[model samples]
Target: MASTSRLLFASSFSHPSLSITTGSDATRDLWLKNRKVPKEHCSKISMQHNWKHSYKCIDGGSTRDKSRGKFYINATSSQSHESQPQSFWKSTKDIMHTLQKFVMSYYLITMLMSIISSSLLAVENLSDISPKFFVGLLKFIIPITFMYFYAVGINQVTDLEIDKINKPYRPLASGKISYKTGVIFTISCSVMSFGLAWMTRSKPLLWCLILYFAAITCYSINLPLLRWKKSTILTLISNIPSMLLTSNVAPFLHMKTYVLKKTTIFPRPIVFTIAVMSFYYLVIMLLKDIPDIEGDKAAGLQTLSVRLGPKRVFWLCVSLLEMAYGIAVIMGATSPFLWSKFFTVLAHSIMAFVFYYRANSVDPEIKDVSQSFYMFIFQMMT
Candidate 1:
């Protein structure tokens, strides 16, 4: 009877159809050793050696089975790494969209064009283009880009609440980026602008960038004593210098020494350019507030549009731009070059007409018309 019971127990231990319980470390170790599982599966199998967590070695193949408190990784899934490029491109597009909202790429393009035009015009001869001219032009690009980024970033950081009302879709106001990130980016850009300007070894250019930075800061920052944007006159006074520097004076200063080998004496074209831009920008500033009248009023900012109403502000902006075009026509007609007269007169006249008609057709509630007109002004400058 004892021998018969012993044989039955031994057979039960070797039975293939029976399910083995891995309740202890000894059983788990015994099962692993008896199966002689591959090294890859051994590591994952060994991790589940706990009283509650159970694992099974599926009999069909070398694949390990995952259960409660246990894990398994498929080698075939490594092919998912192939999707990395697509993931990378999607991330890149998202970043670019964010940057567009933060920095206003359309405005940046126009600013770049204005800077390049002013630089080229400062040269007395078109034939003066050379390697050095290109090199100097290239050098100006970094400082310009950094300064504008700093300006926009800092403004967005400071005006988060205002932007929630005025421009809710913006990266900062929409919570796409944190306020701390915006401040850090702004500070870095500002520092880089100055550092790159210093690298150019031009004290005058550096001073111009400094002044521009100051103007932007004064216009955007709500300092107790220096909140220039709260008043129309102060806003215009603060922003004009920045516009002039980015559009005319700084570029002229940069190129004059390189292309002309001489100091600029306020050439006629440059003078006219600054005058037209200054007046146009003043109009733009006023018109810009027209779309934000509600926010400005609620915030007690006292902008021109809050005082004058959108329709009046719209017409006023159109009239001012027309006046600028008229001046351009006069300057064009008197120019020594026939091509200059023809192009300037024709372009300005068309733009003036476009502004008048477009501004009249726009709905007061939406900013499309006013903002488009603003872009149009910069387009002409370019």
Candidate 2:
């Protein structure tokens, strides 16, 4: 019966006028008209696809599919495959972009350099530090990155209105991300930072991380009792601790994990570096508000630039930075090492000039100029 059915179906397919329909009913009708097999013994056939000269069928309860015109065979099991790795990499790229937006990628270098320089200065012996420093640096990066992302993410969430004027194109302000998602991401980052820090089991690191986080909390949150960012002086004072810890102290603590004793919290070089950075940070923070004067005024936040005017603020920033560079240059020139003086004087003199040139050329109302100089500050630090 099967042989007779196959021959009849083959003869019908050869006929030009007979159109084969790709449907179960069509298959059943054709099978019933040509074959005399009992319904119980004759398995149902499904026509999957149709072409000009071909069709494919899979019989019920059968593990194989047969094609007539262009016979194709599958020797492997009928498991489906997909491009999982490609999808995974695409998701990874998206995550990295979001992370960069959250943490401000340009500022990451400043943090990294802080760790490197602090580690170098923390140890009395320079020759002793080697590739191990970098290995340790890599490990320290995970927690620090999470902490920074959390801090900035919270700031973005709280300062959305101000950012709309100052940085409308930002991910949160521009509506690229929803506020709920931003809050969740920030909270996750906070948890990850603390979890990673706890895993390290270093007393100094845990202590420093706690202090940094406390300062960040006060700087960003709008709690009625602790709106630290509202006042310029309070903002500067609050941010100073986190800045010093992240840049100069965190690296030192990480590097000296095994050798840390009851020494002073701030080393000599760290104190000087933090002083310079505090002044630099204060200038940039003020300049940051210059472009947002309209928004700040609308929000009733009394930033320095709003009170002083942009031109005056611009010059103030330039002058303060110049003084910092001048002091650094003097320190280098007066150092016992002649090479230190030569390099410091040359590098700082060039930086001072560049700062002047750039600041002079800047249009005070333009936020992009402020951002450009902000990046330039890190470039010089590097």
Candidate 3:
């Protein structure tokens, strides 16, 4: 009831007597904050992103999606409608479209399937995989949705540096969207992420969202702190908790008693999966550092490449990826059942190395190879 009241009171369309143009910038920003946040309906992700953008007075719009981006404006029947980036009226109407674009671009549904399915199959090896679409949708949405907003917020916030250097076309830094608007929208999306997750009642998914949000927060901090080394480990290490929680606990979590005790559902395999996925995810995360070395150095990021020099980072990526291969070999040699999966993992691990290795000399090419390798690995998991 409070949320409904706040929404009604905060809405400009509800009272055409209120002129948006007459409002002060502070008033406008506040209204927007209220419209979005609205007496704390902002939910879980709100806190994660709000800290970065609430007071931000930085620089950057909306053309299309987009693959991400931000926009702001109030709506009404008058000039507010006509003057909005589109019609102010459409601004409100288009929100659904904006959300749709966000969901589609991030492949939210598919991603939920990626982790949840893999965990289900690998653990239960379930022959009858009749996924509850609603549940799958919830699980699928947890990670990708969080990632999509965080990426936008992080890009917008951190874009201050990138714009002055290379990307002057970004929304926040380029002036397409105000720092405040971008931040608010990002927070709203984050809130929506958790709000919707809660609706699904999937504790594992909720925990994954919380942890992933934290990792991204850490990513933003690392960018400024020059904890490049720690960031590398974090990029990979953080996934450990999620891997254990989701893959191990989720499937077997007697959806009945699941409500009673979620944490006590631990098993040894989860610990092992946690360590393995962390190592693999870490390798992928660090692979990105190689290409960004120069930009990182210039921005004072002190990334692994800048800290260890480019050659060392390259060898390190190779060495780390190869270690995955070695581990696979050992699994195959010993546990035949695990080895079967190991073969699948080993092939992709080596392929990831080949992609990284071939692109070692070039920077831009690295992301494509790495992404392709990610796709390859995901396919194997499927």
Candidate 4:
């Protein structure tokens, strides 16, 4: 009987849920009395060992089968551990999705345009390609990137309802990001952009940012006697200046006056670029509305697409872009440099042909087709 009691105690002590505590002889005697273990066996056991033990439930709570002397660990803890990484990845995916909606392809295109325009101007100014040029270019790009995001964000915030109808997948429209969050994001971007431009101490860059901000404000903000986008003429007025600033004039002046440390002058290439881009941007401005005609009409926004039928506006935009390409081809053909002449003429001719092909294939009545063509136009600009 003593041997059987000792074996029982050993097994109980070795159980996962049981913990042992060492104690004095009196405490061991008390434990032996309570457990009814034989005194002989208790005496044989080491005096330093105390049989007093307690069962501990693993975290997240546990259940024990007293009849079977079994403990079941809670699955909640293991499940939580497994879900942590998944939860983190899900959150990351959500953030990226929201960013994609906020900073669409157009904003990226804007940044690319700014970088290309600035880099070209830098190349013209500097005798050698150096780190300083890249550094300055980066500085310019940082502010422009923030500003472009701000422009798109603010527009989305203001046009949330319209986007719901026209672009349901957008963050604001889809409820991925709240209106208040979008407003805060745009405000933050605007502050960062202005702060960076101010820190640069470049008057041209500062002015350019300011002008772009004002143009977008007039184009988007719904104030009394404002909202330039409501009227086609007012929309063009706002867009033309913004386009010139974004694609040509502002970048050129900023690079000349700030990065190159030279007097501002519009060279022949700058003027030609401005003219070409102006025409291209004009086409974009008109074409972009075609896909959003349904929403615009519902919102009582008389865009060219809403006023004049989508077909007419579509053809007009195509014709205008074709004209711009034709002019570009002529300009390229007349270039003084043989290489420039050959490449420019060849590139424009090919682009013009591709644009014609793509335009003919698009059915403006289909929103997806019109939207694809709109993106195609932006791709051509880049």
TM-score against native, each model: 0.77, 0.73, 0.54, 0.79
Superior candidate under TM-score, 1 versus 3: 1
Evaluated at residue 342, the lDDT of candidate 1 is: 95
After superposition, candidate 4 runs with Cα above 4 Å error: 1-82, 125-128
lDDT string, candidate 4, 1-382, tens digits: 6635444544343323222335565765674565455654453333223233442212123433323445444465567799999999999998987887777757476556655774575456346357766677777778978898888998899999999999898888999888898899999999999999899987777887898999999899999978889999999999888767765676667667677777666666776787788888788888889999999988999988888899999999989988998998898888899998899899988998999999899899899999889988877877
- Score candidate 2 by lDDT: 0.71
Give per-residue lDDT, candidate 1, residue 288. 74
User: In each prediction, how many residue pairs overlap at the backbone (N, C-alpha, C within less than 3 A)?
Assistant: 0, 0, 9, 0
Q: Arrange candidates by lDDT, descending.
A: 4, 1, 2, 3
Q: Report lDDT (Cα) of residue 247, candidate 1.
A: 67
Which has the greatest TM-score? 4
Please rank every candidate by TM-score, starting with the best: 4, 1, 2, 3
lDDT (tens digit, per residue) of candidate 1 on 204-242: 578788898989988888778687889899998888778
Give one digit per residue, the lDDT tens place, for model 2 in 1-382. 6544553344332312222255566665564455443454334443454455334433322212233323233322232234566778889998778657766866677777777788777666665567766666666777888888888899899989988987787889988788998999988998998898888766656776788788888888888767677788887787866777777777777776633332545555676687778777777677777767888888788778878888888888888989999988887788777887799789889989988887777788777676676677667767
lDDT scores of the candidates, listed in order? 0.74, 0.71, 0.49, 0.76
1-382: candidate 3 lDDT, tens digit per residue: 5534434344423332322223246653564465454434322111111222332111111011112322222334455555766766677766666444422432233345544543443333243334443355445445445655655575556546654454454555556566777677777777877777777666656676676667556655445653223444554555444444444344444231233332344444444444555555555555556555545666766556556765566566566656765665455455546656667566756765665666454433354444454444344333
**Where does candidate 4 have its weakest 10-residue lDDT segment?**
55-64
